[model samples]
Target chain A: MATLGNSTNIFWHECPVGKLERQRLLKQKGCVVWITGLSGSGKSTLACSLNRELYTRGKLSYVLDGDNLRHGLNKDLGFKAEDRTENIRRVGEVAKLFADAGLICIASLISPYRKDRDACRAMLADENFIEVFMNMPLELCEARDSKGLYKLARAGKIKGFTGIDDPYEPPLNCEIEIQQKDGVCPTPGDMAGEVVSYLEGKGYLHYQ
Target chain B: MATLGNSTNIFWHECPVGKLERQRLLKQKGCVVWITGLSGSGKSTLACSLNRELYTRGKLSYVLDGDNLRHGLNKDLGFKAEDRTENIRRVGEVAKLFADAGLICIASLISPYRKDRDACRAMLADENFIEVFMNMPLELCEARDSKGLYKLARAGKIKGFTGIDDPYEPPLNCEIEIQQKDGVCPTPGDMAGEVVSYLEGKGYLHYQ
Candidate 1:
């Protein structure tokens, strides 16, 4: 609800260069691929794999992983519900900025709240925001527990852990959904391939 | 102070593709050009010009202008001292991420505090952070108040404005300084040329 300080005094300075211009220079359309799921849901792996795949194909992309962000950008934040919302909000803003600069911004975060993810999606154009839901069940993620987070949450050492105490509202209509079958996780390469194929099929890779 | 939430539970996910690899793909090194000065000192103009110049030369660059960011990324932030610090801090973090993505990130902000700028510099590698001080006097900037902000601040309509009530700390050992004389502002193209020359002279354009 906070408006621009003295809107009369602040005018938008139109840059000589724009998103379309940058896209032409990069030879690719800019977009935010929002990857959401529980911990150990292969979100980071898929995001990193997609980045590497894009790199091999000579495309510009970057992964804005949640853990990596906590180490720097969101270091001041905690795991409190408010902090989590702020965390996703900041990531959403950063992703929008990167996308505006004409780069594929892959955001790998356990964005538990549907409202939070929806808020992020609202920040970008419909075509620019791609929600890739890693729809692995909570039990499967807990079993993998790559970071021993599930154990900590189970032992009551960490409270409000997503999928344990907190809730993860899965996306109702995500652009891409990668679901686990029979407790089997998909390989990162295959998942990345699916995402890249989607982009290609949607004509996001071809410059107009 | 806020160590990455449960440092034991978090392991650094090193991407197979890294800064160097991205730089190689882009054919340009990543770096942050932190442009600091009083308001109306042509920071945005120089940043946009530099971005345009980089584009013409087939280099990827983006300008993170403060006013533009406030319209989106930092809209919640205000002109208070704490808010100002947070604004620069967030900008620094975003610039770092963009630089990591192998693009020249030009951050144009008032950034009146030395400690705040120093904090931003510390977030980046020594070679990757380039401090560019506009170095124009307050009187000249007031005379050229393109947005009439100086008049508002002088008339006491805007409180806590930099160069009116708050202090503007100049950089002690900036990488570049562009000064205005005889109430004349240098052409944005000329200023941008100086920045490109510095990058070229320092061998930032060549990959190691």
Candidate 2:
């Protein structure tokens, strides 16, 4: 972990309006739906579907996909270990900000490191961070190979590929897990409904 | 300027629902109100006030203040020229995301460098980035010294303080300027109203 520098001569300006007020105004509680998986595991698809579903229901939500972030906020980062950690760290921080603004932030990333995901959870309140694990088998993902990444990894064109040369640490106690059964992948709509149901069941989708 | 690394083997996943759709659903056009000024010039105050004003008017909005960001996303950054530029860069990207999510994003920071601010403007579309300059004189800010930062800078306790030792290159062609006249600063409500009026005039607050 890198040492965080202390900011001197800086003071926090207290906002007259807070997260609670914003949540009330928005008619929903702020939270982060962190979706973690390997490539071709349908993380981005599920995330985008959930975002659209929430929008249809008049709930404000946004998806922060890894690929889209790499073009903007995380463009300086690479696929190296340290850069990956920093990338996740920055995404987690940004998701925290979105949640603080009283929006449901859906973050889709191949955050293979347990410690990095745990750090993100620690950054938010317990109920605000919901970890959704996409437990698709590596073989299934390789066969799907939506982006041909697995084929390239197999051909030695890519290094540090998760679930290939690199390791993926599955979540021990994820809030929701979308798993494959009998080599059948869940539809994006079904996965999105499961997430929305989880939020609704936990009373996080609406304000009293 | 540092060159952004090209993301190899990374492809952007287009969302089924785009920014225009989100803005239409929210019944408002998305935009970023970038407020720049020296420390103690009431940038955060104005930003918060504008947020509250927008909320009361049935508009979704968020404020990205420098103080709040330092505690989270930019905690590793220090008070150096390069670090400050990076800090503003990240904030601009976040603001762009917020706007893309169909919300009015008010970003308040002491972005003293013209080039850095210009780069932020270039990240977004022409009409989406509205730069608001808090044209408060350095002497007034030093006299107010709400955070005592000016005193520290005067005593040589703080290095590279904007307007003390460092340079503050004001915006060449900002959309709006809130200048203090005769040592009398605009009231927070009045300033907030001014920003709201600007947005209304530009047909951004409500959907046509």
Candidate 3:
């Protein structure tokens, strides 16, 4: 009898079709590319670009951005601190499932805290979790404010907003970082290519 | 400004790589084969067997049994009525994500409530949700008593057990029904073959 959290008497069910076979079928290794940054730091843009690039290369990939999940899977959750942690936990578990299904899961979120992000990393074994930091400066992101969220936060309309009212803890040892080049941001395609090349070099592009 | 539940001003991130393209890459249609049954009715066995069969045919699939999910995504839930409902809801949402990721998502659960199961069915659009009912007799499940759960339920050690104290509402119009033929239980491979045959007939075995 195995117990997990509040669940007792649970057993691990081993299926005959495991990850190796799935990778062979999809012709690519399963993994999670976690993109973390502030609201306007281009995390979702990088996720979308990476997904499109991988698809063009005949590689299977899926994006799990806040826009898709906050309404569906995490609908009951609010912007409170506890709810935010639970939100990240659930997304991490779901991303693990997508990786097990032999798809490159790209999770983009304004995951401001390092502890929550590290907890997600611990869920995946070995090097399956690849953290990509959108290392754009606060000033640059605030300047863009594409969604006007920064403006609202600065006006005290949105409480606990990341990089404005709340803290945005940067990753100390992320695998990849996407930042501006000489005060100029790189094109989406270029940033995506950078990640794709990393995946290729790491042998995540093939089943082996 | 879009609002969904407690989430306000959320946007839908539309990635270039979508379900159709993912299906084309996997060479099969993405769907959920939800196996519902009482305890000891061989739902997990059928799931494992089906997964193996799909593997032999060179198709991508993943199993989302309680053993895998209850300890992960749904760990925050419990055995209470409200927790059970939330558990099923989260599973339904995760199964939707798996389907969208272009895999044969096999979700094996003893979801005894009709409302909960129907709620899950509504989550998936069109014929994507294939409900497979394990219509075994209660007596048969009680006799098998796999995991000794039936004995525990009978002894009142386990409260609100399905088919014992709690209800096990059957599916009115599920896509497939697996039960003993002539009072003889089908072998696991035979049962898996039935589901595989259904998928093959439905053109789910190929990417159109």
Specify the highest-TM-score model's number.
3
Candidate 3 total steric clashes: 0
Classified by CAPRI criteria, candidate 2 counts as medium
- Model 3 chain B weakest lDDT span, ten residues long: B1-10
Candidate number with greatest lDDT: 3
How close to the true structure is residue A157 of candidate 3, measured as C-alpha lDDT? Answer: 81
The reply for model 2, stretches above 4 Å from the true place, is A1-6, B1-6
Scoring the B chain of model 1 against the true B chain gives a TM-score of 0.94
Higher-DockQ candidate of 2 and 3? 3
DockQ of each: 0.52, 0.65, 0.79
- Across residues A1-208, which tens digit of lDDT does each residue of candidate 1 receive? 2358532244567788989998998889999999999998999999989999999998999999988888878878888888889989999999999999999999999999999999999999988899999999788888889888899899999888989999999999999999876757788988999999999998778679
Question: Which tens-of-lDDT digit does each residue in B75-156 have in candidate 1?
Answer: 7778788988998999999999999999999999999999999999999988899999999888888988888889989999
Candidate ordering by TM-score (highest first): 3, 2, 1
Q: What is candidate 3's lDDT per residue for B1-208, written digit by digit as tens? A: 5777877657788888899999998899999999999988999999999999999998888899965688899987777888888988898898898888888899999998999999989999859899999999999999988788889888998888889999999999999999999999999999999999999999888998
Candidate 3 ranges with C-alpha deviation above 4 Å: none
Highest DockQ model number: 3
lDDT of candidate 2 vs native? 0.89
Better of 1 and 2 by DockQ: 2
Docking quality tier of model 1: medium
| TM-score pick, better of 2 and 3 | 3
As for lDDT, the candidate ahead, 1 or 2, is 2
